[model samples]
Target: MEVNIEIPSHFLCPISLQLMRDPVTISTGITFDRDFIEKWLFSCNKTICPVTKQPLDDDLSFVITPNHTLRRLIQSWCTLHASYGVERIPTPTQPPTITHSNISKLISDASKSPQQLRYTCLQRIRSSIAPATTRYYSSRCKNIIVTCGGIQYVANVLIEKDATRREKEEAVFILAQMDGYDQEFKSVVLRNDDYADLFIDSLVGLLSSESSSNRERENAIKVMKMVYSVADPTRLGSVEHEMFAHIVRVLRDKVSKEATKNALKLVVELNPWGRNRVKAVGSGAVHVLVELLLDERLDRRISELALVVLDQLCGCAEGRADLVGHGAGLAVVSKKILRVSHVASDRAIRILSSISRYVGTAKVVGEMMEVGVVAKLCLVIQVDCSSKTKERAKEMLRLHSRVWKNSPCIPPHLISSYPTN
Candidate 1:
């Protein structure tokens, strides 16, 4: 016999609207499933209790006491309805505790004593950077770290003159991971001009440090990328020239594939500002991008990013000069069209269009013909490409067909596709 048992409305979590498992009570006396409430408080950063509408604690150290009574009642009800296919709820594991008081004491002692205890605390938190595969300790420790000024403490480790290089690297990596969890912490850190300056300076310094390992450079670039993700245009535009300089240096140095990719993205994001475009160009960004585009083994994503940056850089005269100055620049840009993804092809066309429209002197247009740029544009028209890309390609072809249509570089097969004068 099959029976559908109706779950009692009162036993449902207010947020999930599902039958409550491991119910827990917050200070507002409202009950919710443990997972749902924790997600609400920690993940969603909601300050108010869901049902009661009362403001919860600001520090995220507020306790969520397990409602053993309600949990047992739900379990018993599930058992009673077992015949109807309702499985009994197993005993839930106890939630991890956030010892705010203990963390605060540790931070205070570390600041005052500055000895073995501080190092030990840092080591413990440092080890907690592992992902929360199953052990919730890392997540719990991070919560404790943030609520008890442990985040600031960790950031301070980077600023500590006495801290070893390894210590600073570890601290930077830890804060970078923590940056993923809490937007509140990010906002708080960025709001303080002193902390934000120290944070950025620490990353830039570590990246450029002679003693900094490849791993350290990779981690620093990753953290800087994450920080830039949350920054507004004004803040992004206001970033220091040294920042842009080192970012280009990272790309130029090719510290690691991941670091290069991040630097490319950072360049793309920051180049919208006139000052940034000028600074990045002066930092030899256009030259590095042209070289990146010429890499035979470049990943599609990196290629796409490079072309996008190139497309932006070409907006300035110096950027265009650098692109044209490279022997392989026009050829590489032409090669990527229709060979990579749609975005890549679009950017490549845009780059060509920029040169043809703004910077195409007779020698430049002749180089375009020599490099098979005209042939690639003709190919774009014959293939299945986006309308916008095809239009741009056609535009580039028509703009220069008088000079390039009869060139020996154009394949006989693609000549018919080129627009007439």
Candidate 2:
């Protein structure tokens, strides 16, 4: 009885028992001393949430049914949490917000002003956000902001052409930014399949709202450039409209410049199955493109768009050939004697050569060769530097002779007619 036993003063921390209280862990990661822990437990009528009385049926069991002797050891720790807010302490490292207001404002203002003022407005917009704000891909808003930012930047830069050639193209750069943020946008796309369709239609509607100026084509050209830049060609073919006269207007007009070219570029990128819906834009696109090809005054952009649409028409093995084999196909050929200077249309050269390869499309080709497209092909073959253009031109000639064996090759100077019968 003379010998006395003493308990060790050291105890486990209420939060992470790896150490003692000097500090001890409570059920909610709070650290306290035995004294405070015991007091709080007693104050709360033992084994219950102090705040909500929800019952401390949680981890860090020391507080749940803390033995009075040990709980008293943690008593001091209870005051630390009640004084300091724990809910405010969340994991660090969050991302920034996406701000597209400036971009939208500038574009809206530019659309209403004179063309010269519009360029200046774009320059101001580009200078403000071009280099820094857009450098990294944003991970926050499911990439909707990224897509809009890209199309916005493209509106500013595409028309300028060399706008960012030295600094990294806004369009291409935005696309690359999206690549890093794919998971974000992909989720949006999965949730909303019609987003792309809605997006394009909205932009088209916005640009057309400009009533005073004919520069809408220029606006559409730049917008379409960006859209087609990332446009899923296979999915793009499904896009159609009843008011295609607007696009036809863009192609045939001298003011719009590259307007139709943008439209045609999207048309060519599509898979064959997709081409039918795009082709369904009625004969307005075809009629205007053909007529424009013959006019020397017609801008290269229009010619290029027409040629591309025509190429897609003639090159298709499906019902597109049916559209071409009849009067529509002949009408285009009867107009253009030679598309000598209009080389920008990828649709022109690609589809010309492509059309020659399809056996069923020969009726269209027969009309093609007779329309002076073959002689133009021959001229292009002699000197066209691009391996692609040259190769396709060569194929056009071969198909021309094979399909139109009886039709003599017409000299480049004269327009050739399809057999009227």
Candidate 3:
């Protein structure tokens, strides 16, 4: 038979009715677990202690000192009842404080401390920067971190003479984490004309630096992606040529799966701007994307992104020319149309549409016929693709049917099914 032992009511938090972990005293002279009280105070915004009904005040400046005596007594009771599967509570360390004021003070202290103390402070700040860990605790903390100069402090650590590689990586990682959690912070940085370029330039420098680790490079790209996501068209138009080159280089280097995806996204996001598209074409992004498409082991999501980018790039004459110029480009794009997901298929068909409509010289037309693109279009109509996609395919085939149908490059059987515009 299993036996149950009663936990002393004095050892239980009044709010939770569970044995307290890290019990703390409020101004009401009542003790509750630190986690419960904090949530009540900060998240629920309650001014009174749960049991005493005493006012905690709007300012909430009460010190939440640990009740060591109660904690020890709880541990003793657990030991005495060990036969009933009772376990002793481990000693509790300080839980993360969710207040914005505490967060601002933390940032200020880290920024002003001496070298050794500063590093310690940076570590403390780093702990609070985790989105996965701290996001549920407070949104206000994220605001404090950004508005209180925390980001600048972390960046300064990267340039500090005595900082170790690990510390530098931590700083970069913290910035990246902040970007993930805080949308308001992202908007402020991108919209701030004084800081946007300088901030991006620093990330680019870190991405290009020989001494930065692979992880650091990943963090840099992540931060770059977040910044670019919020930047307006006018601001994006202001991006320099060297920045595109670095982005292309990161894609070429294949830093990580995530890094590569973000780099591709950054390129596609910028391609809508004429100047950015020209810069990307100049950086050989077309060739790099085509090469990535040729990889048999590429993840489906990665392939989808690659095709999406290729479709965007093909909007410009230069992008279309690059696609036609590569030896396997037309054939590879045709192969992907029906084989991949609906989005990839749509993007692939659009790329073929661009080539057929805008750049369809006799030779390019002949090549499309020979590469099975015409047959693929016929198959698109027969398949269960989206109506919009089927319409595009039919239009592409009709646009070049005259040149393609009579040519020996097209198969005799498929030619009869070709639709004339």
| lDDT (0 to 1) per candidate | 0.79, 0.46, 0.76
lDDT of 1 by residue, 29-111 (tens): 88899878866764444668888777654322235678999988999998888888888788965444447775676678667
- Candidate that would win on lDDT: 1
Runs in model 1 lying further than 4 Å from the true structure? 1-109, 131-144
Q: Can you write out model 3's per-residue Cα lDDT over 1-76, one digit (the tens) per residue?
A: 1246777789888889888878888767889988898667644545577897776543333446678998889888
Number of the top-ranking candidate, with TM-score as the measure: 3
- Model 2, TM vs. native: 0.42
| Worst ten in a row by lDDT for model 1 | 55-64
lDDT of 2 by residue, 46-156 (tens): 555343445453322332222344444334443334344312122212222324653455455445542323333333333333334444423433244444443444333
Backbone-clash count (model 3)? 0
* Every model's TM-score: 0.71, 0.42, 0.72
Q: What is the lDDT of residue 208 in candidate 3?
A: 89
